[model samples]
Target: MSTTVWIILAGALVTYLTRIGGDLVLSRFERIHPRVEAALNAVPAAVLTTLVAPVATTGGVAEAASLVVAGVMYLRGGGLMTGFVAGAVVLVALRNLVG
Candidate 1:
């Protein structure tokens, strides 16, 4: 009814169409190439880096320390939840101590 609602619906429709289109095209192939699969697998990490890089760069010491702890946990084979919990703990502790 509203312009904002129309815009949101259009965006959702476009997103759905693109996703379905990609699935349809990929489904025709018997097997995906290793390189293509690797690239697809890397997409999440690339997107995450894009999302976090700016915050990490501009954030304070507490944020930096938390991110470092989270990264260490990940490198040590911790699960995503573990890394997030560890980072949250570090961030809260540091903010309390620093502020």
Candidate 2:
């Protein structure tokens, strides 16, 4: 097999193992501890910040405004999906306005 094929197979195997390992670990616990629960809850927000912070700082007003709307929606008790929709709608509207 070529190097590219080997790399692809290795990547797939690693990804599969990661998913399985997470499931196995969580399943073994009858009830997660409060601290663990808190850590788990923080993961999504941390990931979101890392993913969005760069583009949000560098992008145009539409991007910045969309992030603000999404953040506010989330803080106001909207679901993640709702926040995503709010951000996307704002971004699209602003893009059209700017264009």
For all predicted structures, in order, the TM-scores are 0.74, 0.62
Please report the candidate that would top TM-score against the real structure: 1
Cα misplacement distance, residue 30 of candidate 1 (Å): 3.3
lDDT (10s digit) by residue, model 2, range 1-99: 999999999999999999799778998999999999999999888988798789888989899999999999989999999999999999999989985
Models, CA RMSD each: 2.3, 3.5
Specify the poorest-scoring 10-residue window by lDDT in model 2: 47-56
Query: In candidate 2, how many Å is residue 4 off?
Result: 3.6
TM-score of 1: 0.74
For model 1, state the Cα shift of residue 43 in Å.
Answer: 2.6
In candidate 2, residue 81 scores what lDDT? Answer: 96
Residue pairs with clashing backbones, model 2: none
